[model samples]
Target chain A: MRAGEIAGRPVVTLDTAEDIAEVKDVVFSHDHGYLVGFTLNKRGWLSGPMKETLDWSGVRALGPDAVMVASGDALAARDAESGATGDAEDVVGGRVITDSGRELGVVTDLVVEVDEQARVVGYEIGGATVEEGPGGDRRYIPLPETFAVSSSALIVPASVTGFIRDDLSGFGSAVDEFRAQLEQTS
Target chain B: MTRFAEAEHTPVYSKASADEIGRVIRYVVTASEHTVAALQVGGRKSKALLADWAHVVGFGPDAVVIDDEEHLRHPDSDYEQRVTAGELDLRGRRVLTDTGYEIGALVDVEFDESTGELTALETDRTSVNGDGLVAIGPYAVIVRQDAVRPEEEPPAS
Candidate 1:
């Protein structure tokens, strides 16, 4: 699933079935390669931001309808003391370049492997490297088993260029093949 | 049960003197307890006056009766100060669930006349049972997710 789609989904509590808050933004840890947590806002229009944040561990289920939690107590004050910093938007628009010095594209969105443990498995890119048209066509590039990511650029192995897929439907296998190739080369 | 709208603007009287003191204006709520902490009394030519719910003798149909005019005082605590400043009044505030769904705007509140305990929170679209209330913040009133239901749906099991 695209991480952006989860942005506006309501955070519902399983125990009381209350829609306590709405997802304001998805927080992703590029260093850890997984969802970190979410910044929240009050549900109604014009409602102000919430002080507490919902950590990824507190999420019971990331369903199509809502982000489920055990109860309102699942939300906790953001720990500024822990240096917790991750806003998924920081990665979007960053240049996607290979370690071999090939500039592929600019990141458009994150492809999340949705499950009990949802994680970022690939990135959707759109730029001159993907196509030749006026609006460069978008493509999905699998992430290597290990890679370096920063707010400015993502450095993947050159082998990733060959595994880029046109869409997300069969992107899973491409990721698997790309990982296998990297393991074999190492 | 008495709707806040029905209580508002009603004349307030002192049981000890049987003299009219002021009119009930707004309720100062203790959000955490889901109870009315105090009543903002006005309509007299003086500073903003408040009577704690504990001092209220009765919420009569035609008037509100208090123990004495002495119970009325100036807003003191930070919470009461906020309430007196029109920042913490529940009426017209948006109602939201903990999950962040917008239920509706709180139009009125129903409470037990004798105990000052809230009975229900009424919005244009639905009525939430008082027990589901979580917090009444400056931005919105937060309730349990299951507590919000479509006007037509049966209460959740």
Candidate 2:
């Protein structure tokens, strides 16, 4: 499932049949590329700060509207560094610059493989020219050869710039190319 | 695959007679497995049917080709749950880091056109860290917080 759909949906408990909280975030394993659990934000102003994270095992089912859990007990606090979620990083809006300091665009989205293993594989870059209008272009870049990130900026080598594609179908082609290159190197 | 954003409203045609059956609606995937189980078609508000993946023949650029109308069936409980929870669309969601920094909103999603499998997410925010993806969920698209740098803009003089 795309992460956008369930982000703010209500969380319900099965036993008591109560609407407990709204899903604030979806946590997953970066390495395994699978959903791990969900973090809960309190319902109202009076609820106070509650640390409730429901692991994947705790989920009974994901329906069209609300997420069903076995019990309120399923909502418990989890260590940020634990398997409850992979290393959480915010990349969208981070600046992209080549090793030689040529600025690209801001990261607007990511293309994740959502089969059995849901891992992030690529990114969409919206450069200044693309963001100037409604019909502006978006460039798709495959996961690069070497890149680095800081809280503010995303850095990649110049060689990776050549792999950018402007459309979703092109992204598929780029993935194929990258996979083939990997096989050749190995 | 096309972005569900782009795939939405895409017409579905029957291979038997090449008749326009319905337009694309949304994809239904299980929460645990994250695998697309079916495609909800005929439109979002109308009495739509779940097009089981088994009968899906192709995800063409212009239209989705299906075996026949017989493959379209009423959605079951599993499919209903994901829809009620709004797990189908990941576009326009927000992004946050582990350090509690709010990044930006998601704008696009990439998918395998052939299998209708989701491949990636695009956000309004910029990134150069290659594929520094960490996790995604209802709250935010979390990446490696340590690799994040402060926003590049400087204070006005």
Candidate 3:
């Protein structure tokens, strides 16, 4: 599932069955390919953003309908470890550059591996760098296990260019192969 | 429970002299304790008069009863000075959750008439339980995220 799809999902506490909050944005740790947590908003129309952040470890399940947690206590103060991380929206529109200094394309969306763990696996690229092919204006590039990411660009290994898929249908296998290659090289 | 609105402007009487001293003005609240610390009694000609909550004999509907006129005193502390100037009045102050969301502005405060303990914080849209109150600052009243009840969910299909 795309990280964008998770935004606006209600966060429910399994113990009380109370809908405590709504997901405002999915914060991601780009360098580690791990989901940090979700920034929340109060659960009502026109309710503004909340101060508490929900860490991924607090989540019991990320169901299609709602994100489930053990209890309302799961929402906590944002500590130094999870604080200041970028959300998925921050990565969108940022440049995706190869480690070898090749500019690939601008990031359009983030593909998350929802079943295994809610981790970012690939980037959906669009704009001038995308090839004219079956995927139309977008292309999916698998993320290496570790990479460098700044506010303006994501730096991936140059070998990632070879594993870029046309769409999400075959993106999982591409992610696996890309990681395998990185492991072999290191 | 009595609302601050209902208590304001009510006449204050002295039990010892059996004479009316002043009218209730604004309440001096201690946000940390979520209780009324004192009462600002005005409508008198001399300097500002304040009656600590401890001095209040009863919060009757007709009037606030105090032990005597001596119980009323001049504003002594910086906190009391702010209260007398209407700086710390909770009404019209915005209510913010500890998680950083501004829910609404405080409309009225409800408290126990006998003990002066806060019972609820009311906004135009909702009422937050007093137990969830975290702090009341000059800028806004901060509360726990769960203080305001969430909107009822649409029935599941």
| The best candidate in terms of DockQ | 1
Query: Model 1, residue A179: what's the lDDT?
Result: 93
What TM-score does the A-chain of candidate 3 achieve? 0.88
The regions of model 2 sitting more than 4 angstroms off are A1-5, A13-18, A28-35, A44-49, A57-70, A80-89, A99-101, A127-139, A144-149, A157-176, A182-186, B1-157
Candidate 2 residue lDDT tens string, B33-118: 33456777775445658787778898877898889976788766843645634663556765443333445676765667666554
Residue-wise C-alpha lDDT for candidate 3, range B1-157, written one tens digit per residue: 9999988999999999989988999888776688988888998555678889998998989989999888788889877887788876788886655444556789999999899898989886677877777766555666655767566211221
2 versus 3: better TM-score goes to: 3
Alpha-carbon TM-score of each model against the true structure: 0.64, 0.41, 0.57
Candidate 2, DockQ score (0 to 1): 0.02
Q: Report the C-alpha lDDT of model 1 over A138-180, residue by residue, as the tens digit.
A: 8889997655578899988998989988778889999899999
Question: Top model by TM-score, which number?
Answer: 1
Candidate with more favorable, higher TM-score: 1 or 3: 1
* Poorest stretch of ten by lDDT in candidate 3 chain A: A10-19
User: Residue B62 CA error for candidate 3 (Å)?
Assistant: 1.3
